[model samples]
Every structure is written in structure tokens, then in C-alpha cells.
Target: MSPLVKKSTGEFEEFDEQKLRRSLKHAGAIPSEIAKIIQQIRPLIHEGISTKRIFNHSFRLLRRYSQECARNYSLKKAIFELGPSGFLFEKYVAEVFKAKGFKVKVGVVKKGCCVKHEVDIIASRPDKTIYVECKFHNHPNRKNDVKTALYINSRFLDLKNNKANEFDEFYLVSNTLFSKDAVKYADCVGVKLLGINSSYGDDIQAIVNKYHLHPITSLQSLKKKHIHALMSREIVLAKSLLKQKKTLFELGLDEMEIKQVFSEIKNVRRSYE
Candidate 1:
């Protein structure tokens, strides 16, 4: 019988190796590396093992096998590092939209029919404009619930009514998943949602991977202070680091540290190629 593994949400279920295998494959691990990782991980599995422990163990092994794969596997956890505040995640989301060819404005205050509201993001293309509300949580199991969707939709309606022609769509995006009630509410109201496992086919993870917009926090080489410093300079994406050699120097990264940062960046870039 499979040992029961505890999830981050405090739920328990029978361990499924196939689920672990799929995640490894998604992280760009080759078949041989995946098998090796599983071989090592299976012995560590025991009753009531936390998913976090399993992840850490797998990540360590994957890092040994390939830096790029480890980085890719760590993407979700890295996003959490974007905050003790949601502001950085908001900026990251803006970058994602910018990569998708939308001209984005973050932290915009627009007057609504009822009152003024500060929007997290306003993404516009030539033909349409989208108002985005970003809900970022540090915990993976934290979900955007029905109340969140209801509030966001109400705000959208106020803005849309006030400037109906200006905004064509509203999107509620998050780094975490949404509850079923949230999804249902959003669907009923015509508000779009983009989060993990989104039915719309454009979840945050998918978009990030699709455009190679991995956040700088995703780099194992960078410390928290280093990440905050880069973000303060508006350098959010890992790809952007390639052109910011001067900024890196200003951040006080010594020769060895800079070399490590650049090396990890190269490996991350190569993962897609």
C-alpha cells in the first residue's frame, strides 16, 4: 500500500508516483534523471510525510542533475519569494502582460461610478483594454475565494460603467489557485480569471513558461536582498538580467557571485531552447 502524503493544505492522500513523475517531466527532467529521482525519493516516502519535505528532497536531487531543471521545478516556490508584499507580484504580472504584447500600467487609480479605486494592472492592446486585479499569496494552498471574486467584479462593474467604452474586459489574476465558488461566480458575471489550473488555458504558470518570463526570484543563485534590489530597479524577469551587468555590480555582487548569477541565467535560458 502507498504511504499517505500530507499536502500543503493539511489534507492527506495516498502517495502517487505517477503524479511525481509528471511534475518531474514538466520541469524538463530527462527520462533517466526522472527515474533516478524517483528511485531516490521512493525510499524517503513514509506515512504522514509533508509534501514540502518531498519537494525539497526532489529539488535538491534535481539541482544535482541539472541546474535548469531544478530552477524550473522551483518556479512555484520562487513566486512566493516575490512577496511578503503583493506589490512585487503585481509588477511581475505586469511584465507577463508586457511579454504578451500588452502595454501595461501598474497601480493605476481610476475613478469609478461609486468611488475611486486603485487597479493592480491595466493591460491594453490596440483593440481592447483589460483591468486586472492581482491576488498574491505566499502559501501555495491559499486560494482566492468567492468573496474575492465578488469584490473584484463589483469594482470592475463600477469602472466599466464609469468608462464603459474604455475597458473591454476584466481579469482577476493570482499566483495561487481559485476556489470552485470563485470560478463559478466569475463565470456567471463575465469576469475572466487567470490563476493556477485555469480553465481558460492561460494560467500564470503557462504564460510564464510560454514567454520564458521566469521571475528573478526563481534563480537559486540570488539571495532575498539581491532579488529585492533587482526588483527595485524594475528588473523582474530572469532574462532581463543578461543586460543588467552594471546593475548587478551596483548590487555589490562580487566576482564569484556575479559569475554564479550569470551562469544560472544562462542555464535557465537554455532550458527553453
Candidate 2:
């Protein structure tokens, strides 16, 4: 057999269950559970089977052993699933801010010196106001580079006069990691960051866990088509999807899957809560 290719990017590489093993371990699976998952999925590893399939299979099996590990698995794609653009992430961030007691508005356009700029999020409280930029990425490996940091900082600076008035601080939030230079600039220039590799060091999962803002696209009981079907309707959060269980009907999932996924969603919500 030739080398294996990843489903996400079509890059071919050799299979190593050790990587899966390590990921499960890092996600808090014990050694015995880790070995069991690798042993089960190892045979499915061969030429042409996408690593994404392998990963989904591994996560499915891993869930039976450790739900925590399964849920903590890279949540980057869930936010990625939210888009044609970063709209869903922006909405989700707004939801997070709402949960944190900020009055939130998305796609805020304001006059800078020369032109108008749209802020991804504007959240105000009785005490302070903040503006936010959400940097969404599909891949966990894709980091918010320094260029992004500089551009966002400049955008904040241009809006610093705040013609609308408020916003004591500006924050950049991302579903993926951040570059070293991005973090450095943020620290030096005082642009607050809430990214995976942020200087402030907040885990997106931890926020999701705290606020129960689980992404519907991460449901393993639902296949890619099922997730996509929901995403198409702007149903990105698990909390929202499970509320309208009937929406799952049009996604072409059978009754069994519907029931199964509702159960998974309940468990996922419980995990986050």
C-alpha cells in the first residue's frame, strides 16, 4: 500500500497510531483506554483512507471510554463549520459576551478618521465597553499570524476616537492558536487577546465549558452532511440545534441518528455545563 492521505487537505503521509494514542492521552484518556482505541482503529488505517475519517472513527471509539477526551478534541473545526465567513464565530462570541453580561452588537460600523470600519463585535457593560475581532480558522494548525495582529491593532487604533463613544479596550479572539509575534505585539501594544495561544491564555473549550456554548457541528452522532445541513440554516450551536430537534429531520438523518444525536447533545451539554 502507498502512503495515506488526509481527508481535510489530501496530503499523504504514513499512519502512526501513536499520534492518535498521544492525542487521546493528552485529552485525559488513561493508557488502557488509549491502547484500546488505537488497536480498534489501527486496522482501518491504510492507503487512501482519509485521516479525517480515521480521526472521526477514533473519536467515536474514544467517546465510549472518555467523554471528556472526546469533547476536548480540537474544537477549531466547529467554529470553522460556522461559515462562509466568520459570521458564526462573531455571533458565538457575542453569545459568550452575552453570557458574561455584556450588551453585544455584531458587525458594528463606525466612522474612523477617513472611512468607515466594521467592528466584528462591540460589547458594553455598566462599567466598561470593549470591541472585539474574531479570527476564525478551520485548521487547528493555522495560527493568527503577526500580520493579523498588526492589522487588527491598527483597526482598533483608527476607531480609537470612538465617534460612537464607549469601548475601553479592544480584544482579538480566535478559534485557533496565535503566532509568537502576534502574542508579543498584543502584549506590548495592549491589545487583549482571547485566542488559543493568547497572552491572556483562555481556552475556547474552557469558555464553551463555562458557558455551555457547545458547537453543534462537533456532534459525532451526526455525520458531516448532518452537521452541514444544520450549519446551512445558521444553526451552529448545539444548544440551539437541540432546541429545534425537528430541524434535524430535513438533514436526512434517520430516526435512529436523531435519537442518538439528541442523546449525544445532551451529554455534550452536560459536559460543558
Candidate 3:
């Protein structure tokens, strides 16, 4: 194995298997499977090999043995592929809320004190209305920071100031982590923040598993661009992928690719069910 490794950013850094092992474990791979993954990919590590290559190799192997772990590890990338439109993320979040028994509305527009605010996602219950601002990041290096918390909190305040009879709490939900300052400000101001890996809870992984809300990008057969194209049409879930079968061809996936994609979808559907 080479000491130096190429990062996704094109930066070279020392290889640390501990970080790799930690990531595999975090994705819910069992100890034995994690060890097997390292053993399988360990030999191919070279000084100049892109980490992407290493990851793809390991993911292929992991997907064979543990679809659950592979999909969990791919969660962020799956969400990233939903980009060019954050609305898909909002819809995904809404699905999670629906799974939890909330009546969710996406892109809800309501009047604010200073301006008209189109809230990203909203959930209503018998006793409360949950106003949500969905912040989505495409890369792991980025996080929901203090400025976002501040801006969202201000928006919450404006919404509250309005006479609109809504919302017991204002929440900012992201498929990423929050900065320390973001957490601090939210806590101080009583604004709830829900991030994928947030310490404050609303664990995205737990919610996904609970709701079986794995995104379409979890399919190993779909490439990044294919995912973005599907997402542009607001297709995010595995179920949606099956329903909008024509969208696959519209995205330019040929016959072979489409067949493979459907095959992957079948496996994914089985795992979740």
C-alpha cells in the first residue's frame, strides 16, 4: 500500500486506514465485513491512486455483501446527486416526515412580516405546525453554518411575527452536519436544527432506515449524471424511479444500462421491504 493517496479534491495526503475503517463502521458494516472490505481493497492502494477509485472498489465489494451498509455510506452522495434543485431534498425530507406521521407540504408559501416567505417544507399535526427550512449541501466538506442558522432563525421570527396561525416550532433540516456556532445560536434562540449527523438528534440515518427512504442514487447502477437528470424531474426515491421508468430513457441510459438499473432497483426494493 502506498503512503500517499489522492483525495477527491485532487490533493494528495497520507493514507490512514483508521479513518477508512471508521467510515465503514459508521455506515453500519459489521466488524467482520469491515475487516473483509479492508482486506479486499488494501492491496490495490497505491501512492497515486485516486481515493475515488479506492472507494468505488470498496463500495462494489460492500454492496455485494451488505446492501444496507453500502446504501447508508452512499446516502450523502445520493442526496448530492439530487442537486441542481434543492426541492428534491425538500421532498425527501417531507417523505421522512410523512413516514413519521406528519402531514407534510413542500414549498409552502406564506406571508411573513417584512416579506413573503416560501418555506421549504412544512408539517402539520393536530396540536402544532412544524415550519422547516431545508438546507442541502452537495459535499461533505461543507456544513450548515452559523449564518444559515441566523438567517433561518430570522425567517422563523418573521413568520412568527405574522398573524398566521401556524407553527409551534421552526426547524432547519439539512442532509449534513451543523457548525458549532450554528448549534450554539440555534440553542440560544430556541430554533431547532436537524442535520444528518447532528448531535442535537433527528438523525437522518435513523430516519431513513425507519422510513425505508433510501434515495434513487443508492442504486449502484446509476451514475452521478443519471441521478441528477432524474432528480431534475423530481424523482428521488427507489419507488419513484420505478414509477417514472420513462425518465430513465429520457436521461439517455441505453437499453443495457436501463436493464441494469431496474435490476438494481429490484434489489433495493427487496432490501427495504
Arranged by TM-score with the best first, the candidates are 1, 3, 2
lDDT of 3 by residue, 49-78 (tens): 888888778778877889666666677777
Name the candidate that leads on TM-score: 1
Clashing pairs in 2: none
For every model in order, what is the number of clashing pairs? 0, 0, 0
Model 2 TM-score is: 0.72
For residue 80, give model 1's deviation from the true position in Å: 0.8
Give Cα distance to truth, residue 136, candidate 1, Å.
0.8
How do all models score by TM-score? 0.78, 0.72, 0.75
Which prediction has the highest lDDT against the true structure? 1
lDDT of candidate 3 at residue 78, scale 0 to 100: 77
In model 2, how large is the Cα lDDT of residue 3?
59
Q: Considering lDDT, where higher is better, how would the candidates rank from best to worst?
A: 1, 3, 2
Mark the regions of model 2 whose C-alpha exceeds 4 Å error after superposition.
1-67, 197-199, 249-258
Q: TM-score: which is higher, 2 or 3?
A: 3
| Model 2 agreement with the true structure over 1-273: per-residue lDDT tens digits | 445656566677877666777766756688898888888976777778887788778778887888666566646556677765777788888888887899998897888765678988999999999998988876667888899999988888888865765579989998877888998998899998896423366666677788878787677777887777777786767778667867777667678878898888788667555
Decide which is better by lDDT, 1 or 2.
Answer: 1
Candidate 3 RMSD to the real structure: 4.1
